[model samples]
Target: MPRLKKTVFFAALITFATLLSIFCKMENRSNAELVKTDFDQQLASFQDAIEKKLLKAVLQRNEKEIKQSFLQTRAKYKRLEYYIEYFFPSTSALLNGAPIDEIELGENLIEQPTGFQVMEGIIYEQPTKENRAELLNEVKKMQLNLQRMSRFNEQYQITDAQLFDAMRLEIFRITSLGITGFDTPDALQSIPETASALRGIADVIAIYEPASTDKTVSSAIAYLDKQPNFNNFDRLTFITDYLDPISKYISSLRLARKIPTVASGSALHDDAISMFQTNAFNVDKFVGNSTQFINNDKVALGKALFNDAVLSNGANRSCTSCHHQSLAFTDGLSKATGISKGEPLLRNTPTLTYAGLQRGFFYDLKAGTLEDQALDVVHQKQEMNGSLTQAAAKINSSKTYFSLFQKAYEDKSGKADAWKIQHALASYIRSLAPFNSRFDRYMRGDKKQLNADEKKGFNLFMGKAKCGSCHFAPLFNGTQAPLFSKSEAEVLGVPSTTDTIKPKIDQDLGRYALYAYPQYKYSFKTSTLRNIKKTAPYMHNGVYKNLTQVMDFYNRGGGIGLGIPVENQTLSADRLNLSKLEIEQIIAFLGTLDDLP
Candidate 1:
């Protein structure tokens, strides 16, 4: 009887414990759902406010009202940028991408710029009665975008892991785009907008992991609040001290919670606390799995092939003939002499310093990759003038070349081919990525790296000067922020010479020769500004002889500002009106981009 009673009591206790466990799990799930619902409600509220303001601004056609409302809408978007950018990237870009339109070589349709940026440009450019109709249309597009986002939120589930990852990526976005003023170029409200975005992240984090909220989060907010005027704010200090620490803390919390990220491959690693961290930019980020053949042996073989004149038809010119390391990989000429040694080449020789990081190659962006670029250069009539077949046969005839190719390709069979040679050359070129510029060192918390003038120059570059809008941060190239996937081409309308009195637009036609599109009439790939001092004779035609001349051209607003009749100049025709001192400051900042030892 006693044994039976004891067993019955123990069974009852076990049953109660199991029921309690189930109930707790049910409660936790309900809480999660509630949190998600609350977040959705907040997003809906913000979107509704934006819609209301946009409609009001469109109807009134008041420029001041429109600008104010647009800024409000952008702030709200920034608040939810992390969530929307992660889940609905396409829709998000449609809502607020840059005002530039992009079209590929063979694509029939152009990826026209739509959204806030478009509207911003239209309204900010003149804000007159002429743009009222266009502004209204843009507002309608934004409304549709809001609807799309709402639908996405309604259907998609938000996981804790995703939230964590989204927050980290948001931190990266703030570092790359927010601080650099890439998005809000016209108004220069990056500093304030960044604070709002950070607050949004904190709010979301608090909802997901209430107990994990710590002093670091509040400290970041406080630091942002304490920032000075946009021009005077020390971006280097803010990023290194507050932002980096906050990012590290958040990453630590995520790891401690054992949260599984939704997508680990593309997401920022925990060690990447700041944009200037040694491992911040992945060397292989641009190189996809399909074409990653870089190794020491291959690079060695590539170096040999690059210097060898056997690849050229005349055996008198090599890759190094035009791209010498001493001159920052450029031939230091207005235009390079071809192997024929007849007339100058059509376009200027671009530097190979950061060429590997760029998606599109050459001034016209004809080649899609470094490999394609190498082959094209070798086979071009005016360039190497060498057929791949002939070059390959010549190389295979030599025992040393055959052995080097085998070692490079990891083929014991000892074969030499055109593809392998191109790959080797491309590998050598790609190995020239220089990330150790003085600017890089400064960003990595080395205060002594930049003097007061250089720091001020950096601020101007990112702010009022509007250089960062195109050059971008970190790489300081057209490789777009956060992802750094594709390079951007701009129709700057470069002239034939620096004769501002009688400037004539260069007749190259740039990418138009390939695409035959009017929009691509004067389009040229935006090259890396790295080592600009060394790679002078600026522009696609190398028209500007010095940096000062180039700055003067830009200050006057490219070819259009020089009174050259270029209808589709992508660069704004309005003069930058930069003072001589400001120009000097900018040059000082640019000097820090030199990566030479």
Candidate 2:
């Protein structure tokens, strides 16, 4: 009887435990509801700073303050951008949300153009002759677009907040691509929609915030992220409705520029934005182009073809292989080295920094212009390792390339002949002009830009130090335009580092290669000191490490090699006797000569 009673008690205990478990789950669900409300409150506080300032600016209708508000709005856009990159992600759809920054968001709120500043981030264009006209036209259009951008802002009655919001929304749209190839049909389209979506964004205010009101839930706060969706449009559909138009527009525009988008715009070949435009030479960045010298399209083409590896005998080195762009078109090497296992390039890779600005080309002034220089590099066995015929054949093989010569010279039967290739390459080389350093800005009336010491240094360069006379202004080069003026070829008695004693064999006779003039012995074209800070280990041999060392070396009149100098063994025909402080100022000023942003 006792055992039967115990069994009944155990059954009762099991039922009790099951009831308790159900009660615990119900309490947990209440906690989850509380956590969600708290999360929403936290987001509201983030925009409170922006909301307070903007509301004040609008209510007061203070135009001065509104302008200030616009500037503040720019700051808020940055803060929200930081929040998205850090806290919330755009792809998250928690009951839908306003784009990170409302002010910067666009009226159109669509895809393409608004995100980036004009021409900042790019996928890299492949410049070619066939599509050259189209690319150039597009560039011109882009420049024109910049000129016309103010009209759109005025038409939309865009507030500063709207502009910033549009750009911010663009950031996420572009980020979605993330280093991949994609068309921006919608990128430009988004600009218009951004204006509308921006209105849908809610301006919420926190009514109350009290500590210990309720750890789980707050009835006092009311802010939720909610954004509008266009009719029958989910995210993908909305994006397409807005973005597809932009892509179609840009594609059609290419036709006027004679860009052969797959047999002159066959419907199948329409989307070339994502497809690679290899050998599209005309619109590409110059390896070295003649635009600065003279806008010769053929010269530009020749430069492009010559710089390519396909023109080489071993198919290894392009002309650019040695002479690189970042190195100011000088191969960072003292002597030029050929890529093949054959022979060392006999001469030093002379800096072509301002070659286009020169009256003559090459260390010896052997080549009169860019065309003369490119032709030598192509035919010479050690350089391009290609004859005119071989280079032409190599170009014809590229389906993209076959049309370049035809379009460039208007000769449908263009075999790789001498004229077209040389002209284009030379044209490309000459366009590289670098003048807008801090120094240039100072010259062009930004007086406060220079530090007191740098100003003193500028005076030294012009006066006591005597650098400006030879280095020259703007170009920091001696060669002048119009080629008729005689360019200076000074015998600066530049000591060859290979020699310790008074030199004989190691002496580099510069201009003597052409005229065989005795006075031109050891004369080399003066390089532009602009961006000299970057191109280091200075001189013909890459000898010195710093500007200070170079300055001291010159001050001492050709330091080690010509320890005991003969006549004309110094820099600047007049000997510079600068104080130590003066040299520091000179170095400080030289540092200012960077490519202007």
Best-fitting candidate, scored by lDDT: 1
Clash count, candidate 2: 60
Error of 1 at 329 (Å): 0.9
Per-prediction TM-score, please? 0.90, 0.47
What is the Cα root-mean-square deviation between model 2 and the actual structure? 25.4
Give the per-residue lDDT digits (tens) of candidate 1, residues 1-597.
Answer: 699999999999999999999888767783346556666877887778767886787797766787888888888888878777877888888987878776655658788889877887787776666688888888888878888778877887767777776778788778767876677767778888888888878876676568763777677777767873666677766777777787787777778777765543342343465666775655555565555657888889999989998888878879999998898899888998887655699888999987887778988888887888889989988899887778888888889987887877778867777888888888888888757889888877778988878887887777767677788777788877666667888888888877778888888999899888888898998888899989988888888888889888888988889999888897778787889998998899999999949
Report, for every candidate in turn, its global Cα lDDT versus the true structure.
Answer: 0.79, 0.46
RMSD of 1: 6.0
Mind giving the per-residue lDDT tens digits that candidate 2 earns over 1-597?
699888999888988888878777655653223333333343344235335653354345444553454344333333233223212332121111211122212352333232222111121234345333432333343334333432332333212222222223332232122101111121222222332222211110011111223211111011001222211112222222322332333333334333333321111122332111222112222223433234455555655675677767767778788777677667666566765564566566765654655555666666766767877887777777766567767677777666666666667775556656666666566555545567655544465667878876765664455465456543555542111133344445554553444543335556655555444556677666777776665665455556887777556555323454444332433346778998998888888876655
**Listing every candidate in turn, what is its Cα RMSD in Å to the true structure after a full C-alpha superposition?**
6.0, 25.4
